[model samples]
Target: MADSAPDRYVLLLVPSAIRCQCRCVVSHRAGRTDSRLAARCAAVASVGAAVIHFAMSPTHWNDWMPSGVFFAAIAAFQLVWGLLAWWRANGLLLVAGVAANVGSAALWVMSRTVGAPFGPHAGEPEAVEAAGISVLLLQCYVVMGAGWALYRRCRAEEVSAIGRSLVLLGATSIMAVAVTVGLASGLQGHHHGVEAEAGHGPTTDEHLGDHHDEEPTAPGEGAGAQTFDHHSESSVVPGIVVVQPPAAPAAPPAPDDGGHQHDHHD
Candidate 1:
């Protein structure tokens, strides 16, 4: 069965939840003592690493260099401040960030082995690269969420922290899965729609042949017949013909740009 509009909308919400989770962690840790100090240091280091990484790459360096620098700087600041305010909390955040990076790098390696650079392409090979990147991002988001949960648990009142963290994690995970699967399904549906349109003309004969073995029904018989049943004391009207129209063609699937796959080449 095809995905519904609501399902696609839910899918688009997944990445947004992931992004919100990342921002929440950064924001929540911003005011903590160890978190502040660690955030600053981490920000600087992240910026430096990003600069070096961008410098090493010659292709579209101008386009990506700024973003790399920005994320690095943000990471460094967030990490330093977070660590300074709350050492344990900041540590969890750092670990999450590191795990995300490692996961992304692993995906990049897999893509290289498969001969698809982390960019758009024409076939399943290209799709594999895209899928790898999506999985990597999802993993990173999950880690960040886990870190945020840890931070919350560390700082909140003992009575409520654990419960709140569990709730947040559960909600985010459901959103993530729903969004990713919905978007992927939507993309697949689009590809199928295109193929169907392109191949529609010649498939009529094939379809007919597949259905040819069904037994023929006599006219005015079976469910196709119009009939009236009358009891001894009942009067019935006749001469009414009921006709069922052919079903309309299904509409093309909508494009989901908001859920567009992230490009994680660097």
Candidate 2:
């Protein structure tokens, strides 16, 4: 009877043990799945930021050499990092990403609000434009995803493959819209800047044409030309004409003065 009791207990506990093991396996898988999704989302965000930086680098370079170089370097680093995360994201990489993205986003906010602390444009606040806003949004997403992965919160439930795909699709759509609108806004801004710079001064031909269209001043009307008459010689310039007064008759000879002195001597 004692042997039978032990056997019965062993049989009864087997199912519980099995259930516990299965739950552990499932929980572990769910955690892994959640972490993977976070990493992937972060990777996508990083790649999107890289694309925007790449597109803006040239324009920024045209405005300022340092800004262009900075953008280019950021683009390259983010691209490489994003690819690495996509391939295999580890804790160290996730931490690094979160740190970098947070710093970058902070700097962006500062630039838009107060101004950049250094560089040629120091203390000059930049406008909040579409490209910049898009980049900010992507950076924010990157930070959130990387932080989520690092913390491992909300990992109790398993997300299905379809759900992951939908998430990715939504993210991609947001990035695409941002990139498109941002690029368009940037191009328009550049075009307007060029036009404004060009419009600062009028061309010589246009200025001359404007003056030439005016009616000519009467010859003797102005104080400068009061001595001038209808017969006076004229000088011509591109858009102006000046009349020169005739010379006075040579002083009637001092010859008369020499004759008056000889009469006084007599």
Candidate 3:
């Protein structure tokens, strides 16, 4: 009977090996699908963030912070999903990915406010601001691309769709940067012009006032000089009167004398 027990143990080992191989194959297939789902979910989260950033103006951090946190959470979820996928639970990974994306979308919606903190003038043309936003948008694209690549490695489907999505996101991000930079530049120019005009305006007013005062002083000085001239001339000719009427008086006296002589001769 002891010899027979050894034979039975060998028979059991054969069956165990066959079962192990079957389990391995199943696990590998499940892992492949799970990894693909995780990657796709991550890509969707990244694309959503980009859209939120673009559509909103004066994007505020108060609301944006939650979205950022949501992004981090999605990444964590994807890691877990990848692990589950490795363990042959593809369904769990799919569920987790979908849940994460939903959370991300909700966060984006909550962040939308009626007015932007920067008062519609945020993200204007200072090179540093434009450059910072551009870098941020680029990072989003990079993360999405990385996720898509990983997904393709796992699933091997829809290569064209992945490429197209990447291209579209990149182009949109570039256009957004261009528009932001242009607006900022225009605002800066307007501000500078207003400052310059304000600075020069006071100086012009001051100069004009000085000229006006000088003009009044000139007229005052002329009037004083004229008074002095008139006073001097009047003092020089105070009571002088010149007349030449003596010749007329002498003709009147000769007429009276001739009339008396003619009366005596008649």
Can you write out model 1's per-residue Cα lDDT over 51-159, one digit (the tens) per residue? 3332323322333554345445533543443343233435646575556456545644554445324334212232233333443444344344445444554343222
Colliding residue pairs in candidate 2: none
Global lDDT of model 1: 0.43
Relative to the true structure, candidate 2 reaches a TM of 0.61
List model 2 lDDT by residue over 1-107, tens digit each: 77899899999999999988876875567534776778788888899899988888898898789988998998898888899888787788988888888888899
151-238 per-residue lDDT for model 3 (tens digits): 5443443334566456546555554664466445323422211123434356777876655443223332433332223224445443
Better of 1 and 3 by lDDT: 1
State residue 134's C-alpha deviation in candidate 3, in Å.
23
Candidate 1: TM-score? 0.25
- Range of the 10 consecutive residues with the lowest summed lDDT in candidate 3: 186-195
Highest lDDT among the candidates is held by which one? 2
Off by over 4 Å in 3: 26-58, 62-99, 102-266
Looking at model 3, residue 215 earns an lDDT score of 26
- Clash pairs of candidate 3? 124-184, 125-184
**Candidates 2 and 3 compared by TM-score, better number:** 2
